[model samples]
Target: MPLPEKEAWPALIALCIGFFMILLDQTIVAVSTPALQTDMGASYNEVIWVTSVYLLTFAVPLLVTGRLGDKYGPKKVYAVGMIVFTLSSLACGLAPDMLTLIIARGVQGLGAALLTPQTMATINRIFSFERRGAALGVWGSTAGLASLAGPILGGIITENWGWQWVFYINVPIGVICVLAVLKYVPNFPPHTRPLDPLSIILSVCAVFFLVFAFQEGEDAGWAPWIWIMMAGSVVLFAWFVYQQRRAERAGNDPLVPLAIFRIKNFSLGNICIVAMGFTVAGTPLPIMMYFQQVHDMNPMHAGLMMVPQALMAFVLSPYVGKLVDRSKPGKLAAAGFATTSVSIVLLAITMMFDLGLVSALVAMTLLGIGNSFVWAPNSTSTMRDLPHQYMGAGSGVFNTTRQLGSVIGAAAIGAVMQVRLSAGDPGHAFGQALLLAAAVLLVGVVASMMADDGTRDPS
Candidate 1:
C-alpha cells in the first residue's frame, strides 16, 4: 500500500535531519582542528587522526549497515544509531583527553555508518517513483548545505565559544531527530537471510588494514609494517571475494553479492562515484587548512569563504536533478566532471598567483555548481535500475564505496600536501594536489560515459 503523503514526509524529514548531523560533523571537525590541537595538546598527526578515525569507521561499516537495515528495519536501526550518535557526541564534548576524544569520535563514526544508508533506503521505500528524483534532489541539497555550513559553524563556535561546542551542538538536533523518528517512522520486520560472519570479518579486516596503512603510511615513512598491512589487505580482499562466491554458489546469503558487478553500468558508475569521492571529499580539508593556517584567515572568515560554493550548489541542484530524470545522467555527469576540472584548474591558477577573495569565490562557485551536477546524477544513475528488494544492500555498497574513496582521497591529498610543504613550496604543492584531483574527476567523466542508462536490470 502507498504511504499517506503526510505520514511519509515526517519520516523523510527526520531521516534528513539525522543525515545533516552526520554530514555536518565531517567538515565541522575539520575547521576546528587547530582549536582542538591547542585545547588537547595534540600533535599534528594526532589531530589529523581525529578526523581520519571517524571516517575510517564510518566508511567500513556502510556495506553491512545497509544490509542490516534491510534485514532488520530501517526505522529500528536508524533510531538506535541516532541515540548512539547523540550520546557519543556528548561523550566527545566531555572528553578530558585526546585518547578519550578519539575513541568517542570513533563511536560517533560507527553510529553514522549505521544511520546513513537507511536514509536512502527509507526514502526509496516511501516515495513513489515519480517523486523519487525530487526527493533525492532535496536529499542531495541537504548534504551540500551541510558541507557548506559545517566549516562556518565550526569556525563560529570555536572562535566565539570554544571547540567543545562543535560536538555539543549536535545534542539538540540529535534529540529532535530521535523523537521525530519515534513518533512517525514505521518499523518493518527483517528479511530472512543467513548472516555471513566470515565475509563480514574478512571485509572489515581488509578495509581497516588498507585504510590504516594509507592514512598513516606517509607520516609513518611508509615503514615495512605499512607495506605488510597493504599486502594483507590484498590477500584478505581476495579471500572475501572467494568466500562470497562460495556462499552464492551454495545457495546461501553472501554479505555482498559479487554478481552486482556484472552489470556494466552499475560497475562503471561506481567507479565514477569513487573518483568523484576522491576529488571532492579529500580536497576540502587541506584547502580549508591552507586558507586558515597559511593565509592566516580566522575560522569565521575561512568558513564564509565557502559560502559561495554552498549557495551555488543549493540553487542549482533541483534543476540538475530534474535534468537527470529526463535526460542522460551520464552526459550530465560528464559535463559536471568537465566543469569541475576547469574549476580546479582555475583554483590552481588562483593559488599560483595568490588570488583575492573575489577570485576564490568565483572559483568555488564554479566548483559547487559542478559538484551539484555530479553528485545528484551520479547517485541517481547508480541506483536507478536496481530491484526494489536489493535497494538496501545496494545503498550500503554504494555509500561504502563513496566513503572508502573519501578516506583514500584524504590520505592521498594529505600526503601530497605533506610532501610539497616539506619541500618548501606549499602553494605549488597545493596546485599539484588540485591538479591530481582534477585528473581524478576527468577519469570520472570517462567512467560516467560508460555507466548504464538504467535500461537493463542492475543485478
Candidate 2:
C-alpha cells in the first residue's frame, strides 16, 4: 500500500534536509581551504587531508551502514547518526588545530555513512511503484541543488563568517533533522540478518585502499607503492566478493548480499551511478579553474555561475518525476545521460577555445536539466523491483556504488587534468579533462539504455 500522503511527504522533507546537508559537505570544503590553512597554520598537504580524509572515511562504511539499518530500524540508526554528525560538526567548527579538524571531519564522515543509506531505503520502503518516481525526484532534486549550492554557500560563509561556519552550519540543521526524524520518520522493520564483521572489514579496506591509491597517485608521482596498494585493493576486493558468494551459499549473512544484483535494473543501475559519479566529481575541476584562473573571477562570482545549473534542475524535475512515474525509466535515463553528455562536450569545446562565459552557462544549464532526469529514475529503477526486506541491502549497495564512483572519478579526473596541464595550454587541458569526463558519462547512457526490464511501468 502507498503511504498516507500526510505522513510520507513530511518525512521525506525532513530526511531531504539532512541528506542535502550531508552531500553539501562533499563540495563545501573546496571553497574554504585558504581560510582553514591560514587559521590553523596547517601545511598545504595537511589542509588537503582535511577533505581527503573525510572522503575516505565517508566512503568506507556505507555497505555496513546500509545493513545496519536493516538489522536495527532506520529511525534508530538515523537518529544516532544525526547526534554523532552534529557533535562532530561542532568539534570541527571549534577545532584548535588542523589535526583536531581532520579527526572531527573523519568522525563526521562516519556519521554520514550511517545516515546515507536510510534515505533511499526509507523512500523505497514507504512509496509504491507508481509514486516512487516522484519521491525519488525530490531526492534527486535535493542532490542536484546541493551540488550547485555547496560552492555558492561555502563562498559566502567562508568570506563573511570564516571557514568555521561551514561546519557550524550543520549544527542547527542536524538538530532539526534529529527532531524531525523522531517526529515523522517511521521505524522500518528490522532485516534480522546477523552482522558480518569480516565482510564489513574487507569492504572497508577495499574501498579505502582503492581511493587512497587513486587520490594520492599523481601527487606521489605514481610511485610503485601506490601501484602495489592499488593491486592489493583489487586482490582484497576479489577475495571479499568470493567470501560474500561463499557466505550466501553457506546460509551465513554476507556483508553485501549478492542476490540483490539478481534484479536487472539494480545491476545496471550501479554501473550508471559510478559513471555519473565520475562526471559529477570530474566536471567542476576544469570549469571552476577556468572561471577563476582564466576569467579572474573570485570564488563567489565563480560559484554564482553554477546557480543557473541548479535553477534548471529545480524547475524541470517535477515534470521529469511525473514522466518517470509514467514512462520506462530506461528511455528517460538514456535521454538524460545523452543530453548531459552533449552538454559537457559542448562546454569543453566552447571553453577550450575561450569562446565565451555565456556559452559555458548555457551548457551547464542543459547539463543540469539533463541531471534532472538521471538521478531519480535510476534510483527508482534500481530499488523499485527489490523486495521490501532487501531495501536496506539494496539502498546500501546503490549508495556505496555511487560514493565509490565519486572517489574514483575525483582521482581519475585529477590525474588526467594534471597530465594535460603539463603537456599543453591550460584551456586545452581543461577541455581534454572535460572530454574524458563526458566519455565517462556516455558509459552511463549506454548502461541506461539496457536498463528497466518493462516489468513495473511499461515501455
Per-candidate RMSD, Å: 2.1, 1.8
Residue-by-residue lDDT tens digits, candidate 1, 1-459? 335778887878888999988999988887788888998999987887788889888887787888888888888899889989999999999999999999999999999999898988877777665455566777878878897788778878988989999999999999999999888888766778775888888888988888888878877898999999999999998999899988777766788777667756667778888888898776876667657776898767877878887888878887887776677777888899889888988887777577866777789999988988887787777776666666778788888788778778877887877777778766677767777788888888898888766554322
Residues 229-329, candidate 2: write the lDDT tens digits.
Answer: 99999999999988898777776689887877888888999999998888887788788898888889988898888888888887777778778888888
Q: Report lDDT (CA) for all predictions.
A: 0.82, 0.85
Best by TM-score: 2
Q: Which ten residues in a row have the lowest lDDT in candidate 1?
A: 450-459
Task: List TM-score per model, in order.
Answer: 0.94, 0.97
How many residue pairs clash per model? 1, 0
